[model samples]
Target: MALVELPYNQLVQWVIARGKTPEDCNKRLIAVEELCKGFFEKHTSIPQDVKDMQRHVHCEYTEWYEILCDITERLKSTEDGKKVNFIGQYSYEPLYDADKILRAFRKNNLHIVSYSQVLQKQMTFNLPFIKKGIESNNKELSDYKARRAESLRKLNANINELQNRLKVYCMDIKDYPFNEDFEVCLKTRLTQEIAIKNANMTIHNYHRTLKLVEALDNEVVPVFKAFVKYQKMDKNYHPEETMKHIRQAVKHGLEYATNGNEDTEERPSDDANAEPEEEPLIQIVKDDNELLVAEDKRRIIFSTQLGQSSFRQLLLGELLELLSFVKVRIDELQNRSNAANYIFSQSGENVNELIMQPISKYEKYIEVINEVIEILSGTDSMKALSILKNRSDLEKSAQGEISIWKRCCKEVAEQSDLDKRIQVTTETLKRFTSDLESARKTIKDTKAKLEKATAEVMGSPVKIFGEIDNI
Candidate 1:
């Protein structure tokens, strides 16, 4: 009886209808293998005129049946990358015994038939769909890069303007009204620039991620599929050379995906647990004769000291936090001093109001700064250091401030600081955008090189499989 040729959709249904339990599939494979082996033996003793027909039947039974068995095994194994795919209401869990159908078609050596015709038909419909899916990802990657580039360009232009403004402020403000205020402005701008740079870096990372997606669609996934295809061509092909190429292609794909620069060298001893090369023991010259005979050993002295602190309840951790607070206060005082000096330098009517008035207002902050400096400068002992290191909230740690003065100084400093910070941030964003653009180009070039290398590796099958088939 002739089997009706099924379309891809109908073929999936036919296979689903024939699906069996994994245990049943395994039993069926064993029986089929035994029956094929028995039939091959019986046919070998036949006359030469009939042997050609027998040989063809033997190949079909072994080849298609063996491949079917392998597919069943894959369905059982969780690690298998490919398995019988089901559509709509069909389930793959019961495991389809497509091998049983092929074995039946072989008909115990009564006829020669190619069961692969069904498989070829299914693949013919599916391959173009797979290729189209991969192409869609590549198109998405191209669109993403274009949009990102435009955004980066606009950010760069804004930064350039800010950078120009900062330069003007620095060069022109040699003798300005409220010098401390002017200095505060400069510091604020510098901080803004740093923030913009960070934002640029984040965007660059996003761009790198997209590039990796593109590589997977264009290079890595296709190579992986090729490796699977080669294995399927002949189960016995076991091409070690092809596998090596596959591994290399996968590694290249991962590197691109992770935004890892290939120029970085690998170090085996990067982990702390890695053993160091054995070094010659240090030879102390107890005797002159022994010293002369022994190889010169390099002596490295590593020392650790432990001491009891005089402070009874002080933990080093708590003490460190207190020290941080003191340091922060000192920095604040120094910045105020600089802002005041900048204001004083200007020969203007408002110098007293801008610089001197604010200074008088923050007298308590100045006094705290003096006291902190005196205490830190005096302390050299563990006990003194421990006393200073105790943790407390910065606001409540040292309390002696008139609210009005604090507010007045804060307002003056912020007015100057904000002006500078805004310009600086713009420049910073621009600089980072430029750097991101350069990084993007480098990544693009790296991906291209990787693609070329991958293509060359995949193309080696022409040389590998060419002469071997004839031999």
Candidate 2:
């Protein structure tokens, strides 16, 4: 049977199976059936009105169609073959008309092709994608929303369980954690301390370097320039001119030292007394990680005096200290890795309780949430999420406990694998170490130049930047 002859439902199913939406399939099917019915009625009806068509007593009303088909076939087989339009100066060379019948019908105003062809282009058609029996786009989207809601439901529950566990531990946990039950907890706690310290030291050193750089520009060189000007010594010597260039170089260097990036804006403050500020959020940014992951100790150091900075040095002094801080952090993480390895190896075949035991019920709890985020992975539901945000200090309070468990767990259910994290951290540390001695020579040269200028002005050489007790 012809495709147009199929039942209405069958046609809809066929169209739908070819990736058309159910709504589209049903609408297009109704129109196709109407067009096909009209076409059959005209093609099969007796010719009653047109005198030319009525005179053809050849057994059918549409006899002109068969005659045209015959004419088209004979023309193609003979020298009626497609030829260039020599009438147009042969401008269409090699692009001769392929269908003589189509143009012939158009020229004579006699078109009786497939009836469906007239309105077919008005509708949209799609190729096959998913299998048949799938629901419409609206239904599928609704299902996704339900699944996403369920996932969030589970996510909140798991986060709640994590909060409860941490609360219980914090309320009852000993300061030293002398109990064997807390041995694992103790190690994670230590890891938190180390990370926070490392972060503080990095910021402290960075700011100190900025201060020293600023001192060179604001205090040291300005004082030297004044002394040179007061002495009226430009006639014989022009060391002040050299100092002016140094002042300019220091101004540019200050930008790099403060922000740790190319931007000239001031660095984000890490001081305890500074007003709290939030990182600006994009309206459409909605990654599961934005609210899910706990803040590590490194990020926490900015608000506390855990890493305080108060020192002076040459232009690159902050760069040197930052590198030094990274070295210490790497050493600490390496030690923690070794400790983790030892904890794993201590039990032999029986296995250590500290290594094999569940850190808390939160592990299994988070397991349920693992698939929830994925359900919403392709969704924008997170844009309106405030489950974590609405609570009072929940995000901040959970940071310590959540961060500790992360360091303790070798395999977090939905997070990055522990081994991979260690490998990446180690590789990064190696890169920093390779360039450790970079500014040593530059600082040495800068100090010699400064000492000579100061001695000529004040009889005694002054150490302008490094290890000086006074500003």
What global local distance difference test value does model 1 have? 0.33
Give one digit per residue, the lDDT tens place, for model 2 in 120-214. Answer: 21111110111111223334445545554554555455555544664543433334332345556554443333233333333343344344444
Model 1 ranges off by over 4 Å: 1-64, 68-105, 108-125, 171-471
Q: Which parts of model 2 have CA positions greater than 4 angstroms off?
A: 1-176, 208-216, 227-266, 269-471
Per-candidate TM-score against the hidden true structure:
0.19, 0.20
Q: Which candidate is the best by lDDT?
A: 2
Each model's lDDT: 0.33, 0.34
Total colliding residue pairs, candidate 1 = 10
Superposition error at 410 for model 1 (Å) = 29
